[model samples]
Target: MCTYLKNMEGYKLKDLKLKEFDSIQEMFDRAFKRQKVKDDKETTELKQLMKIILDEEEVEIDVIPLAVKSPSIIGWKIRKEGRKSYYQIIRADGKSQTYMIFSHMLKSFDREDLENLYELVKAKYESTRPVEDLDLILWGDLKTMFEPHIEDKVWKNQQDYKVLNWKLYDSCGVHSLRMQHVQIYMLVEKKYPLTPSTLTMMLEKKLMIDYESEMAYQLLKFIMK
Candidate 1:
């Protein structure tokens, strides 16, 4: 039994035991059946909607599901003649958005561009935001700001990155600063994949800052409401 459990590649022993499944194969078969039912339901609903929206007899639609704490169906990716269109359900009024942000991100940026963007954000944060501000944002525990492995790198090779004094600021600005830093850190070191589509989305959203007055001023604007 121990060797069998060890040999199971993807299935966890705890999960199998908790689910009262006799074997890993059985667990997978049951999960597959459940997912198949869900996929069928989603496909049927999405196909009908796509046909109506496109006003065509035939349309190929791919349902894109957002993976969240409580996962829910979100949108459809329609493809025809080597072109793609995204439609996302966002509000209660039965109105849907033509542009899907997630799909746009996936289609826009590449890894190198993302890395460059991370560096730019980090440089901006370091230059514009004061060390004391970081302390204020993080409640004086600067070391805990980033993950354990990258703490030293983030702290500029210091053993303890502490601020001698802290000053309180407007709650909104402080919140933005904290969010800016957290987002850059996560994008550079965590889950964000360095892909072409991601960069394109950033540019499309006007989130990228530039030295020029016009472009820099435009950074705050987004196409979406």
Candidate 2:
């Protein structure tokens, strides 16, 4: 834990009462400002980073378990001056279910992103949603919303062809097909069509998710006729 966090002796993470905040921006302001390290050199840096994260409307916070392996860290860091800040992550489940991490950004918090995070937390004051949902959603959706040029890193650029890749069209009102190898059936509703293969790649390649999981299979089946 950063020395700044330690001295907020009375302010437990849960006691910070973040559930009251209706927006991600509000939650971040409360979380960042409850500082035990007011005098630290990194205080201003953290404040600035918090602002950058909050200004976005569609930011998603993903809390990786303490044991998960991390990918590369990139983005602005004033402390390091245009370099990625590096730190070790440490967690202990035995006490207070506390998770701790060291990094430019890591999920030291215990909760991950739930689809109904606001809803679940508002009702139960705790969310039971699986953390895997966060991993799948944030790595793709959050990147789409906040990070710049993530599409180039994930899927082929469609700029030259002026086309959308991996499109799905419903067929026969019974099943859907990936447009490339699809057989069109009943063309009644003219909406909600799907293609299994293209949809699979949309979730797999575009989302950077694996194909073997039951969730992946189910999503594919739902899209295919």
Candidate 3:
């Protein structure tokens, strides 16, 4: 855990009260004022990610869980010239979600293209309606958004593509397939309307269902028709 976050852990945003809120605002103000022009790719990425969380229009209690990831980046001391910061992501869930998110950006995107990618992601996420299953939506949709710009390193292995897809889905928030499948269906349907048989084949081969999940079953059926 970052030392700066030790005092603030588990403190949900809604319960901040006046004093606690002020303290966090102070921390954010300090971070903002001292923000520098970053030269390195990693630092720049961290800065942008943190900004997306901190700059949200509304802060609520549930946001604390997602917001906790912010301190991990600031702790790296990336803002200070010449000093490299390493983050030790600690989570009780036996998974370092923040590190996974950061690593996905570093590994799957070209250093030069991360800013563009993050901006597009942030915009798309903000514009979309939040759903109970945000990951499903984001991951499936990301295939369309990111298919064009995958780093050469990432494309070397097809499985890496799947890994990056899921990582972004999990980190971004809840998932659904609303926008993703809609976009795909629209694109393909304009050229060729999917026949019932073709859609059934897609359900069998393309859609990976562990069991007979209702959402998966319905989505495949809907797409085909």
Candidate 4:
């Protein structure tokens, strides 16, 4: 090698064929710029998702989601020792609300496709999410029970309606109302340690019944006050 070639230096040109060193620098600059653009896009999309999931009003005795930003979570669940576990839950009140999510009701994302992505940033707690998202559907799954209650006499009326087979299965804002052939309590009872979607499938398979006052009243009367 010539003495001039050995001594000439700025950035290393060994990777480039010496003549293409300038081209290599330009390529590096463009690649870094593209990466920045992708990051900005992800941040914006993620923020929009949070707005829908994190901002929701809690329904009475319902496991509804609270407000949360990305890298935040406030799901409802029960603990093994029959106690509530407290966490910094983002609420619709535009402030941080603390809720003791029952550990029993916490659902882990089990999809193999998303499992690898989740493993990227696993937390000590199973129910915790890395960020908060928005919930566009305000009513969510509990919408069916919010309907009017009807019966032979005045089941629709709150005064005449009796708490028959009702039972508080899990402490994650879930309850079961019993009536006639349909029983909705089991639906909530089995949701512990699983996602709501999982329990929904159990109902679809005819393993669960709809909201029925008969069983709810009977169960509540026998088991709880």
**Which of the two candidates, 1 or 4, achieves a greater TM-score against the reference?**
4
- Compared with the true structure, model 2 gives a TM-score of 0.21
Off by over 4 Å in 4: 1-15, 52-225
Residue 138 of model 1, lDDT score: 29
Cα lDDT of model 2 by residue, 6-122, tens digit: 444445567656645455345455545765344354434322211111221222223354355223222111122153322222223321111111111221221232122223223
- Tally clashing residue pairs in candidate 1: 12
lDDT of 4 by residue, 97-182 (tens): 33333221222211221222223223322345323221111111122333223341323333323333433432232454434443
Per-prediction TM-score: 0.18, 0.21, 0.22, 0.21
Q: Which residue pairs clash within candidate 3?
A: 133-175, 133-176, 134-174, 134-175, 134-176, 135-174, 135-175, 136-175, 137-176
Per-residue lDDT tens digits of candidate 3, residues 33-72? 4443322443443332221112222221111243323322
Better of 2 and 4 by lDDT: 4
How accurate locally is residue 108 in candidate 2, as Cα lDDT from 0 to 100?
Answer: 27
Q: State the TM-score for model 3.
A: 0.22
Worst 10 residues of 2 by lDDT: 95-104
Score each candidate by Cα lDDT. 0.32, 0.29, 0.33, 0.33
Candidate 3 ranges beyond 4 A from true positions:
1-96, 99-201, 204-206
Question: Model 2, 178: alpha-carbon shift in Å?
Answer: 17
RMSD from true fold, candidate 4 = 21.6
